[model samples]
Target: MTDLLDPVSPDRAESFLTDHFQGVLVRPGDRSYDEVRAVWNGMHDRKPELIARCTGAADVSVALRYAVAAGRAVTVRGGGHNVAGTAVSDGSVMIDLSLMNRVDVDAGALTARAQGGCLLRDVDSATLAHGLACPAGVVSHTGLGGLALGGGYGWLARKWGLTCDHIVAAEVVLADGSIVEATEDDHAELLWGLRGSGGNLGVVTRFTLRLRPVGPVHHRTGVFPLADAAAALALYREFAERQGPDLHAVATLKIAGQQDWIPERLRGTPALFLTATWFGESAEGPEHTAPLFATAAPDAVLTRLLSFAELQALGDHGEPHGNRYYTKSCYLTDLTEGPVGQLLDATREIASPLSAIDFEYLRGAIGDVPDEDSAFPRRDAPYICTVSAQWTDPAEDAGHRAWSRRGVERLAEWHFGGAYVNYLQDEQPGKVAEVYGSARYARLAALKRRYDPENVLSGNQNISPAAP
Candidate 1:
């Protein structure tokens, strides 16, 4: 690997780049350089040699051409919200796409086209204006490019399916600085690879996503005493299995905090929380969720009608950017008693008050899609167990990370042997293959050879090109 840190005269590089580029070129000491380099995870404080703030697909091509010609490592930053912090790297040419956030909604066609740099909130706000939305992540601040490319899931997933399932077309800048549109009839293979492979083949400049009719939903959230966790989880599993496609829910285990909704005595105590949303009429939500409240006997419960956008923003307050984060996750084949016990035990050792163990219910429309339809292949799993650790103090990093790791290890026996690519924090060898399986990884590698033969876009969860 060539050292991207090798000295290149700033004036010469900037002049050459600006001559053909329509975007700003930033260097180490330039104003806004630090702001551009910062990512969602505060743990990565990398210093890139140059930052190319791209305005459009042409600007992306120029940046890629510059990186290839200079023989420098290239890192692409869309929203800079990936937990792994792969968007920016030390001693690399950072292609910053934060400036290219433009959303175009075709209400008549029920589709929306968003630029690479748009956040979940950007797409949601635009699509909701037409009373339609695409299935995406819960946090509004997360980048659309990363989440969708990694097979997005949210409240709408149970009804409409994942974000990848809604993708109709994409505009991509390939490794050779060529721009092309990937649709079912065009560069179709690339589109298949992009659905869940995490941006290894090219820089996606725009994504045209199919939208569905969505509006205010009945949202229910509640926190129960720790003693009720076992019963609550059991009831949740039963409810998830019996519920219709319109129901999307999550059950989380964590220590309660100073929220006004939590009882004063229950604050700072370990608790189990159940959150559910009904995509259909708000009036029917209570009937569907009444069983859960009856079984768990929560200490607090809040149920109301909220816009789809508001429901998406529910988790944002707890997960502010700039907090150090580490996560380990796996798909659950079954939520058996043994794994549930392990999770409860792990929660007892929480290192930070902000840390949590979350289990998302998966079924209905998500399972209706064939596994081979896209690169995302864990359709058989019933749930995804994520152990997330977050903190502000650098000194608490080791403890929190260890807690997360142990939690995953304890529950490994119940895992389906597949992991969510978006939740992956480190580049463990064989991890990609484990996530996608051998056959799908082989197909992805072949696609990589076709579109990114030299591996110019290797900064992400990379799938190397197949041997010639």
Candidate 2:
């Protein structure tokens, strides 16, 4: 039987939380409630009634079951980097695993078992000690659990596949409160859904990832002043097509004055920055990258070979929480003049300093993989572009959000008909259907019905169960 608590009663919610939860659960008046409710993006301002800080797999199981038994919405949090703030829900029970950050590396099997709450930095530090690395996201603080679940592709993606590709096994707590081990040999179908399923099926308690030997290498960042956005886009396309699998680059359109690397006058203008990493040795990287740099006059050329750990932290710091964030992304087929012109048109209207755009080239190990091998089906899409807009005042929310939409709207005609699910913001209920193709979406929907028929986990890019 389920326990019935008063909808407006904190004491009622706290009683069951403290009694059964092995970790801390904060409420409205609690001292740490405010801080615990905050997430990575400054945009998300949700106030859940109970914030349960889970400790282990058992703790996660208890939290989910308790939410069901108590009739409360549940939000599973890890690194809390979901740009849409799906990690926390308003007036719900937040199952936070931020404290369960443990990484175990097994050299004999060339695999690492990473806890759900472990950050990318923790995984890198642990795996790099053995000269091994796996494909992860760019941000160091991004959680391994969410990243792997969403099909992570980082600098190492060219040589190694996305984070999902390296997933050897997973320990998941199903919606019915059963612990299941998903791998290739056993429960294979569930493992297929986990890749890029975005947390719909279960809460992944642990991930066993395949690792490869990666040298302590240098990360190279180059810049070209954005005088003509069209030319920059053309050059990037040409270079990326010819660049072999060893090299990787992401083309960013920044709001000129953000970085000290650009000249004073060029500040606040649209500029192109090429950030790449050479997994082998830093000295040999420039030779391959010279072609791309030669396409335009150099604004800044700062290249140094640093340790893998140092390389990962470049241009990364803590993001302020409690700000309004609106982001949208899509996969692009090309970076031609028409698309570049559309991007520039949208750039001119961005009013917020926090507004910026990025065009991440998708190739190498990411695009080279078979489409059917994983749930991230967009293998032919060459580019992933994202518009991230942020603002402080609630009144300014409309304008910032408009800018984000306009940026993509301008390229609507050129859209590849698919998007990156992780980067999607709130939109039509069928948004996930648009991001993943209709066929793949249907397959995923059926799978969701099998694993989570009641839709207990619907916070992510949700996959609702099929009708009976």
Candidate 3:
């Protein structure tokens, strides 16, 4: 065994790793090392000592065992889309699962099994081909593993619940280099913890998710001038509270850019945008979305029936890879005037044109799930507020981050003090407890102790092992 923290002879390490590993191995000076290390967020620029491009569960187990024997820190990468960039670390053993992307859809069973590296698009393309869909994140390029583990929500959440809610089973690689299948009947507690506690207990090699029959959906997008944003938000709040499970909506405050949806006059101006989707009849969508148009009298309105995959793809353009991204978010108990005003004030001083304040309406099926069903605890939150700062210039990082922090602080009074763990960045400390309350966190820690006693998997939103 070698000390992973201390410097070891490269020739010896490379030879040893090559003798034991079957997948592709890249050392520090390898030609593709830089490309392998680049994740979705440009904020993290780390150089791992070794990169193991695992092909399957066997490869993952081999890598983990080797890392444990060598006493090296390990990080896992699946689609490499984490905003916090926990997938890569300096001088660590990076288990790159990007090559393991394989999706198998069983229409007969109404379920889909995806490898750990499969992105949302990979699963969507396969399942949608069969006219079936799974609840997943909005961004098509995001890794399904991280999103599902952190409680996935998107256009279909109101109708079918979160991505984690639909997960029937998962194949996980435990810390002790053993593989196990977690389902309702076997290793059930571990399965419950995996629903929302993030990549804390172990590395999931594959996920088996329940699928639902989904067809074309009615989509409505409205853009209103900044002057009428407050009134529009109030109307939206009222409508969202009373809306049915088949309808899902989002309110966004952003500097209108050159998007095709935005009218020419609204471009480059501060504006409020409302987007609503109806999973049922197309005719009913306009009825549910009429209140937004009546309130804001938007400059432009685009409503049409679109395929489910197309609706999911819409989020891809706004959030592209290689851009510096920072986010501050909280789950709001309600959307009252005070918090709305604070959000507006925060948006008034936007650091970058790409920056925006977003609100996602939550309830219906999301809240129907009991609090103790999974590690995710904030089921009663009616909405979630996020201040997303995106910029291309590295020099402007400080201003943008500070702006987001201040925005979250101003709206703290209206929030439940809990945040979506998936959206959390590296800078937010002590957030694990907030995301999962004390009782739930304690339960997760106990599970962590049983599955990973030494805390070998501490690269993610970690839950420390409970004391004996």
Candidate 4:
């Protein structure tokens, strides 16, 4: 029989959690509660009644089981870097896994086993020391757990694959408080679901990732006036298609910031930018990138050789924490003049100067993955567009959100009928099904029944078991 606590009275909740939880237990009034509950996105200013800091898998199991017995839900926080701010829930036991970040790299086998609390920087730093890498997200501060579960997209995505593709195994704690090792041969469906399931199935405590050989990479950037966007983007598409997997790139529509590479006059002005990274020998970078300059000479250009770790952190400054963030993402069937024109119009209407409109080129290794092997959708989609709305003012929330949502609404016609789970904002439950499609969602729902049937872990882009 379960020691289910009184739903009305929580007098004994503290004593019971403190006695059972092996790690630190933080109350609402605790000094670190505010800090611990805080997540990357400033939009979510929530407070969980209890913050159970877990040291390892054993501790996480205790927290999940405690939440059930205490008649409350639980939310897990890895690096707490998700834009959706799904880590903390109101009046729930916020399982703080940030303390469990530890990575072990096997250079000989080209593999990295990282704890779920680990950030992109943790695996990048550890693996880079051995001249190897686990392809991950662009922001180093982003959590490895959420990124992998949702589908990791980074500079090396074209060269290698999404971070989830590198995941060979994982140590996950289920809603029922049972720990299972998911891999190809054992619990195969669970592992398949984890590739892009968006944390709907379990609290993954550890991940064993397959690493790739990567070291110093060369990067080149060309900033163009808004007037020259169509030409530059056309050239960008051709270049990305022509170049081999060793080349990875994207086209961004953003306001010029205070970067040394950017001219002072161009600062705060909207510009179309083309950026690419060469994963091959740094010396051969210029030859491959010369064509990018041929289409339209940039207003200014900057090129540099960066170590894998350094390149991973380049975008960190742009995506600062404690800022209101709302984003809508969709994969485009094509990047024709229509989509490009709409993108430019959207960029001009950005309510916040920090906001950006991005076109990320997909395919290459991302498309090479067999569909049956993982649950990630639209791997074959050639382009993914995201409208990022960032602001600091609470007064203009309505305006900023309206602009951001409308920005995506403009491109509805070109949508490839799929969405990336990682970039999705706080949409309705039906949106989750729409992203995965009926066929794939059905498969995942059947698998959900095996693990989290009751949906104890239903905080994220949930995959409901009872869905039709």
| Backbone steric clashes in candidate 2, count | 7
Off by over 4 Å in 2: 1-19, 258-260, 318-322
TM-scores of all models? 0.96, 0.92, 0.95, 0.96
Pairs clashing within candidate 4: none
Query: Considering lDDT, which of the candidate structures 1 and 2 is the better prediction for this target?
Result: 1
**Comparing 3 and 4 on TM-score, the stronger one:** 4
Model 3 lDDT tens row, 1-468: 543233334446544566657789888889999998899999989999889999888778778877776778999999889888989999899999899889999999999999999999999999999999899988899999999988998888888889988889999998877889999999999999988888778899899999999988888888888888888888888888878888888999989989797888889888888888888777677787677567567788888889888988988988888999988888887788888888788878886898899898887888787876778778777788889999999998899889988989888788776788887876456678767878888899899989999998988888889533
Kindly list the per-residue Cα lDDT of model 4 for residues 1-468, writing each as its tens digit: 224222313565556556656889898888888988999999999989888889988788778877876888778899888878889889988988999989999999889899999999988888888899998988999999999999998888988899999999999998877889999999999999999888889999999999999878889998988888888888887887778898887888988877888878788889988988888888999887778778678888899999888899988998898999988888887888999889989878876788899887789999899988889988999888888889999888888889878988899999988788887776875898988888889999998988988889987778998976
Off by over 4 Å in 4: 1-16
Residue 49 of model 3, lDDT score: 81
Worst 10 residues of 1 by lDDT: 1-10
Model 4, TM vs. native: 0.96
Name the better of 2 and 4 by TM-score.
Answer: 4
Q: Write the per-residue lDDT of candidate 1 for residues 1-468, one digit (tens) a residue.
A: 222223335445544466667888889999898887999899888999999999999889878877876778999998898889999998899998889889999999999999999999999889998998898999999999999898997888888889989889999998877899999999988888888888888999999999999867988888988887888888888887778887877889998989788899889988888987788877888887677677667889988899888888988999988899999888887777888899899988997889999997797898898877788878777889999999999988899889998999998788888888888877578788778888898899899888888899988888878532
